[model samples]
Target chain A: MVDENVSFEDNLKELEEIVEKLEKGDVPLDNAIEEFKKAMDLVKACDDKLKDAQDTIAKIVNENGEIVDFDVE
Target chain B: MVEDYITVSKVTDYIIELFRSDSNLKHVLIKGELSNVKLYPSGHLYFTLKDEESQIKGVMFGAKYKLKSKPKSGTKVLIKGKIEVYKNYGNYQLYADEILKDGIGDLHRKFEELKEKLNKEGLFEQDHKKKIPKFPKRIGVVTAANGAAIRDIITTIKRRWPLCEVMLFPSLVQGERAGENIVRQIKRSENFNLDTLIVGRGGGSIEDLWAFNEEIVARAIYMCNTPVISAVGHEIDFTIADFVADLRAPTPTAAAELAVPQFKEIRNDVDQFNSRANLAINKTLNENMARLDNIVSKKLFTSPGEIYAPKEMQLDLTVNRLVHSSKSLIMKNQNRLDLAKSSSVFKNPGSIIKAKKENYLLQFSKLELLNPLNTLKRGYTLAKSEGKVISSSKDLKSGDELEVEFNDGNVNTKVI
Candidate 1:
């Protein structure tokens, strides 16, 4: 399982590695199926992480576009 | 003995009065080169006045010493005062009330002497000098708080490095207490952890810069771990502090400039580095992406399995044809073999043998019609003599033995 607590940059790096491996296309059929499943999961994870960051940033900016500090959950 | 038969106190008083009332000795101007001059802690001055002929001891009490500037050994000066007698030591000394420089002043001599001494000690050696900081976060200045020099330093530091913090330690730059004050400020600035120290004041005579020239101030600067920059007086002016400091600037403004680097220039350099790095990374990424695009557009990537498709189809077709033709050829050959087997004449050997036997029997019947034995079966007799059959009368001879054979019996006969 990927650690959600990892920094966004680290997660992005891992995602890039996954994409590169999939692009190489030398995996065995069974391994390829497994990698494909993992890639799908990683894509969703990255998307979720980005969406969470965007929402947090948005919350920081009010309708007037003024920055404000907020507490973490 | 009778002339000296007076009380000791009275005699001493009389002698002191005689010396004090001497007109030539009182308020007289004496010219000589000064030597062994000392300014005592009591604020009194003591020295020996000497000439080519003789020497005389002189004393300037605190009252008069305070009224005039301090002098040192080898100073050529004229003193206006009275010649007085010391009854205890029985010595005559000059009590100077006024002193003036007849040639070079004693202060200058002392300045030169100290300069020479320190120079020989290698305190002014260039190898000991340290480089001033290019950028100082905070500048520690040791000067009179209200002096023009401090104001100038602050203004220059603000104009050059606005972000830098300026701290001041007020000190008396001239006087007997000046050296101690300057040293104290230097130590205090060190405790404050100032990035750089500017210890100096505005232009002045050698007397004014005397504090900086003092050994105490020099030692303080030398011991300070923080970088020290001395800006004393004008460009031509130098002091002991200057030699001991890390750097010497001509003026306070120069010191400020030396201490702080231009922020704009640094910002420009940083921006340039960032832009160059970004361009390099972008170029790298673009090249990598172009290579990836080239690989993706290649035939192998379009359909990775297409390379083997033709061979696989060829194999499939060949196998099908082989199976179909092989089955048909096997059936055709089998049919030909069955037809040849069914029509074969040599299959029944016993029937051929029987047919041949029947043919032989018919031939034998035909042959039997010509047989003489058959005639004998029809009641005709055959005679023979000596195993010979007689067929005609000519064949029979008188002496011949004849035998007659019937179908069922044999008979013997003689013919004559």
Candidate 2:
């Protein structure tokens, strides 16, 4: 159950592994196609993460609590 | 009225009384670097506090010692106490009650002590340090949100890779309560589900960056489940946080760079993988196709027509031989009939008619000899049962109903 907020490193690593397996060329055609699809998805996920990045400025209000915008500062 | 000159001791006493009477001189906070530091056998400290231009004598009674580290020569310190004039020496000195190692030296001493202790505890061991994520979805920063550190980090991450979200856990970077605040923020960062954490502060004197050097903040960075990148002060300012962190970045911007990758290079890498994938699949398909070609080119498929041609010719040859055998028999019979007609029957027609009549009479007499009436006259009787003549005894069952017909009479009986 991978979520929407997967880290960039994990996604890139999965893409790398898939590409490696694909490059080895030992897998059957069907499996190679599946690996190719997975690689493309990871690349797209990484690209989307970069594209969707937003600027955020926040401050800790409590000892272990939410990050509120430090608008006053 | 000319004022008379006072004695030297009397004048020095007056100056001392004036210094003691002044509140500013009695309770003061002074910042300076120490020089000529000495500890007496009687448990007293003597040092000169000096800045670039001036120097002042300082003294701390042995009873007033509250320092974790003894002050050394050239140590920067902040001294608090009253100014006193030693009448005999005719020199004024700062009688210190509290001596705090100031700026770089004071915080640095504490930083080193904590680093040594934590290192022995294996907190700084390589295996204990988690690898900083190469690609981070969220980065938690424990620093002032409005400061240059946060701004630099944000800008660097955005420029290199924009997909990552930067979460700032604003904390006090300096002052008496700064270490507690930084520790608090680091603890809160655990809830962020971050891939990497950057705990740092901007460049300042050691006093301003002291929070990063504190043991509480260093331990907090060590215990974090998420990988930590410690970036404090300038390139030369090392802190305990840096030593305990998974990675040490010389500056806040460098921390951001360490946590994420540049987008352009990643895209190029993915493009290479795409081409490699195509080549691999095609290579497999081409190899399979060549194998199929090798099989199809073998003699089995190359000359299929010639392989079946001999069998077809053998079937046709058999049919021709069968037709010739029947035709040859009919022709031989025709030749025999022509020879017989010319030599015997056509030339002796009258003799042939007589012989034919005689042969017919002989065949009729022979037929008469095989008649059923002659057998009956020879005392050969015929019997029938159930309109069927039984020729063998084995044909009859032991218990049976039988009807027997003899010559001219019929009888019914149950066989024994």
Candidate 3:
């Protein structure tokens, strides 16, 4: 799997597929362990992405694309 | 063709003469509802004035009144004007020099008319609505910069879908220019390449939210290629923009909720998947281990000589059957021979042969007594001539020389 640039939903879908594949028990023993490890990493990654998020609103009319000061009603 | 025909100028002049001289057509007051109101950039009012029966084309140039906006659509108005014929179109129209807003008594009627017109044009169709993306990386918000509408949308989107970047295109929410400005901002947001857009304002009176009802704003919302969500003033006030937009959220806060999903919910889903993966792998391992344990427990497979023991038993059974059958066959044949030898035929063979030999000797002796050589020995005198014994006297001849032996020998003789 590509490590970067995937959206949360896309990444989550892949994680779900991995879990399902592991659950079906068709994978070899070595592959099953490896798949389990990958799933753990994805869980951690998703959690981190959510925790690191911050909300920002920016104005695009200016050159810097910053928040232009306006009267806050 | 021109024998007695009236000129085009003459016909136009006669119509103008009728309009100018008519008492009611000059400086007359007419009461009706207004429709299709438009305020031009030059501050001139252009619209149609109509009652239920009919409508008249009209305009009030900017040179006359200088005050607030041109009368909003659906306003019952008393207009004083003179009917004048346009030389270009050859149609008489009212040139309203004075317009007074009697009252805006038919707002619902005006709303229904515009809605019906737009609906007939297929603006509110389901097919025209676009699906909001489940996850948006960039969202453009077309709303006033300072109000609770923008603040709520930004906060809600950030809380639920934290990765989304909000681009604000500030716009006027109410005024004569509000609808036009909203259209301008929506058009300008196209450059941002937004995944979705929310155009809304906080709660207000219907007249206060009238900018959203403007056709310019509705048509702009209809024509935008981007998916738009209209979150207007209140739950009860439904505007034309709400119908034309891809989705209608009751309030600005609700629009943010609709735009993005909850982040925590998906994390829980992933956790469930993680456990299920573990459960499946463990199940396979346990089953295989059980199968191996079962196979190892059987003594037939685990120990040596298990196969050889059965084969030895089968060999012993076959050898015993062969020996028993051969012995019984020899004994049966020997008993039959012994029984035959014990019968009377062989034991009495000598007695029977002796009796038969004695009978043979008696018959031989009788035969010897009847032989001719025996008769010579008894009493017969043999006269001999040559080798014959003469029986009759006539048989002797003079001068014969003879010798004779009766039974045992003969003597030679000659005839004389």
Candidate 4:
């Protein structure tokens, strides 16, 4: 079974790569169809990931052993 | 023979002449740990050289100091210069002409000083760093024009992406003046519209790569708007410029690879995309055609207009049947009328009237055969007076006349 919890960014990146490849027209017909299917699946996975309520911040302990919220900036 | 009292001017002149003429003190070498190093606004260098016992004041003029590489305080160095006396304050100092680092140098201290200065100025901040292009149109190289680094970069770029244009801004890569020259070329290459900069020479010792480690070069790299990829020295060696650059490559070839994308891979991807799109379009067309065929083969389509046709045919058949039955009914009624018309009383009322007239005549004849009129026709006469016929003469009056009648003629006679 495929992993349902794949990261949104990873799925999006894969989809973009597939789109780029498709636009570039370098793959064989069979491979293109396969990649297109994978791309569609990735698009759906990305949508699923975004559909859930988001967790704003993640906390991790630094080298000093103090927990801190990850600062996006 | 001895002037016990010498003038101040004469004493100063004598000391100056002695320092200038004294060959032994002219090139004497002194080893000491440096301290109190100060660079004046006039570009002159002032410092103190101290050993375990004592310290000596030293001054290196701007011209000589500018030629020497930077040396930090607490660095151990050997100085070669003459000792001279200043008459103004009557102070003795060493006016140094040459200075060289001696023992384990103060590289770490210099590195920390540069790092701190640049960091405070925000050179190492993420905001100041430029992003490397994913696909560079042109790559500008700032290295020795004929060095191995340039060759490596060209070869690597050609191998990865043959379409990218590589332009070179050649500069001195190793020496006292290398730092300034490298910065100059980097600025010059900016006008060339380079997507990224590859600034370095081949692998070398620390001293050889010292130009790249200079604060000026690091600042230059940081100030450049274009993304810089520094590939100085070997993989083990890193410089301050590398830290400040947008990216750090372990070798010159690696930097070239990072500058451009692979053409072959991109082409292959493009082909794949075309194939996929073609397949999808074909599939859609085929599916639509199949649906159309299915609709055409359905029973309703096979016999078109059938729903209205049957009703029309049934109406026509009923109308024909009605017309035939009505016509036959009318003809049968007409025949019945003809038959009634040909019957006796209906055929000729005049003839019936004639027959009735004959019957009446025959009845009248029968009455005549039974009556006296017929006897009269046979010549028998009955005479009557008044309203009654007289059967005997006893009823006759003496003066009365009697009359007799016949069927064709009537006759009257008088009785006496």
Candidate 5:
């Protein structure tokens, strides 16, 4: 499953591998269909990740060694 | 005599004027080693210029000039200043306007020495360099809080990969204590779980950027678990931190760029992979379907009977031959049998034998009829010339000799 534990890079790598295997055209029909489904799921997961992205504000470590939000003025 | 004596204040003023009026005392250049250097909060620098035989107090107003080389206690320098007396202390000091470093300066020598030592220790080896993550979730930057370096890093990271959390560990990036301050900040960055750390500052002179060349800062960067990108100065400026860091970006912006991939590129990659997968799967499905169609279109499946229709036809012909081949032969023989059965020989055997007797009697009678004796009995006579019988009367007249023939006897007679 494509979740937080599996990084986006890993998910993408898996997706690429699945696509490569499918392109080789020797896979059994049943396994190919199953892998196709898995690949689509991975694509959707990646699309969701890209769409859900939000910019995070920068933070700073203060003189007292405390972490706080400090935007660049 | 009491009237001639002047007040101490007046005498001090007079001395101050005398020292100022002396042309030789004004605008003098002196070369000596700096000692007891002090920089006040008021931006004034005071130090002692001392030689083996003599020493003097010196002051350089900070606002007047900036020194490329920061002079410390043991630094040799040439000072251009005017000798002036302070009324409050009743002492004269060199009021410096300009201070030039006498040689390459201690900072450069120290930088070279530390660089050589660290190189020998193999801190800059390629094997020790850590790989920066292609997609970092958290990036830490250690630089001056209010400097261009921090701003550049933040802007670049935000513009390129905004998904990552950028943490700034601002520290003093110059002066004597800057090295320790930067080390502390780097150590602090470890707790934040930074995937990459950018430790640097904007461009400055050799003396201004000296903190980065410090051994403590270099070792700290080397020891940092997170991959460190050192962006100490502009492209031309190289620092010890740059050598020890996992990656060396020419500037802070470059450091941030090296830390993470561009967001747009990643998105493009995903989209490309998605389309490629789609095309591949579609092609696979199409190819498989085509193969199936080819197989299904075969006579074996579409019309199974047609597959063996010719064989079936051959079998029917064989069966017909089997039935008719013997039947026709037997029918022909039966027809022959019927022909034989319809013949008189098989229908009336006794009559055929009686007919055979009568035929023999008739043949005998005909044979008897053909006999000349029977003709003689009918009173028919035959004449012969020599041994030949004469059928014509002309041949008998011409014959010289003739024989009169009767059914029972023959007699010789003369033709007369």
Candidate 6:
């Protein structure tokens, strides 16, 4: 699935490989259309990820060695 | 007594002048253990030098004393400087221009020795370094719980790559137990499955940053499965942890920058790939369409009858041959019929029939001449008595019943 669960790196890499294959122009017309659609979807997903990026709340290890939210003023 | 009372500033100035004039005080060297070390924001160092019996205040001006590793508390050092009196405090202190580790057990010497040993042991080999993940989802930082280093790392990572999660494995970054604390945290970080572990602290004096130089801490970083980025002290300071770590960042923020890729660059890559794919697929479609057009424009498709033109000509030739042959055959049969009709028997069939009839009549008359009935018709009678013909009168007995056959009549008579 071309969703948020997939790493941005993996999605980008897959999109790159597909583009390379399509650029070779050896794929059948039907498959070329399919891969082209997938590439577009990946582009949107990556763009969405970038635009929706929010500041991550950092976590800290307390003195007792347990992780908890680290809020900065 | 009132006239002899000199001002406090006046007396302090005189003492400062006396120390300046003394040759011994101008370039004095003192060996002592550093204590109460503090590097102010203005780059000035204020510390106390203490021997077993006594202690003295010392100040190292930042402009003149740029050190690779600043001296921290408990670091034994030999300082070369002239005595100077602070105008504000009016207390005389050592204004050091040069400071060096006194002797054995010096932090710098220990760092060099460990670095060389680790290098010889191949712990610092490039092959041993793991590649920091290009897009790390989880980054673990090992540093003081409340320090600029942690804040810098977390803020940098969050700003540049919010998609990534930052986990802090807070540990003492200095003091006696700092080394063991760092080693323990590094070991604990292994269980978190961190993509990158940034073990660091903000810039500080060499002794404050000494935990990162510990052999145990270096080995922990070297053995860590996660890629470790060592960010200790300042840019000029390189610790043993830096040598053993997978990568070394001049500062903690730099470590976060190295751990994950920026979101904008990744988006651009994906956009480029999309355009390329569209271009390629469109090119493929265009090429196929062009090929189809080339085929559709062909004579075979444009003028479909052209395909069967030769076969049609062949069919025409075969039909012409059949019609011509049949007409010739009909003409031949008609000619035969005409030839037969032109023969004498066909032109004069009645005369032939008459001649055939005359010949038949003649044969009939000849056959009639051999008939005995004809003799009866010529007035000769055939007489028989008891089915026997009478040839002579004596053959006929008187009173014998005889039947005479004439041409058209038969008479039963008795001989008289």
| Candidate maximizing TM-score | 6
Task: Give interface RMSD, per candidate.
Answer: 17.2, 3.3, 2.7, 15.5, 1.2, 1.6
Error of 6 at B305 (Å): 2.1
* True interface contacts reproduced, per candidate: 0.00, 0.46, 0.62, 0.02, 0.71, 0.85
Which regions of candidate 1 fall more than 4 Å away from where they truly are?
A1-73, B1-131, B297-299, B302-416
Alpha carbon lDDT of each predicted model: 0.72, 0.79, 0.81, 0.74, 0.87, 0.86
Mark the regions of model 6 whose C-alpha exceeds 4 Å error after superposition: A1-6, A63-65, B1-24, B33-77, B84-93, B99-105, B315-416
The lDDT, on a scale of 0 to 1, for candidate 6 is 0.86
**Which residue pairs show collisions in model 6?**
none
Ten-residue segment with the worst summed lDDT in candidate 5 chain B? B63-72
**lDDT score for residue B121 of model 1:** 84
Q: Clashing residue pairs in candidate 5, if any?
A: none
Q: Give the range of the ten consecutive residues with the poorest summed lDDT in model 2 chain B.
A: B63-72
Name the weakest run of 10 consecutive residues (lDDT summed) in model 1 chain B. B269-278
lDDT of 3 by residue, B41-136 (tens): 887787789999999988787822442335778987888888898777788888888887664446667888999999999999999899988778
Question: What DockQ, on C-alphas, does every prediction get?
Answer: 0.02, 0.37, 0.34, 0.03, 0.50, 0.58
Worst ten in a row by lDDT for model 3 chain B: B63-72
True contacts kept of 1: 0.00
Q: Fnat for model 5?
A: 0.71
Q: Order the candidate numbers by TM-score, best to worst.
A: 6, 5, 2, 3, 4, 1
Residue B309's C-alpha lDDT in candidate 6?
93
Candidate 4 reaches a DockQ of: 0.03
Residue A4's lDDT within candidate 4 is 69
- Pairs with backbone N, CA or C atoms under 3 Å apart (clashes), candidate 3: none
Lowest lDDT block of 10, candidate 4 chain B: B63-72
Q: TM-score of chain B only, all predictions?
A: 0.48, 0.52, 0.48, 0.49, 0.53, 0.65
Please give the ranking of all candidate structures by lDDT, highest first, separated by commas.
Answer: 5, 6, 3, 2, 4, 1
lDDT of 5 by residue, B242-279 (tens): 99999999988888889888889989988888898888
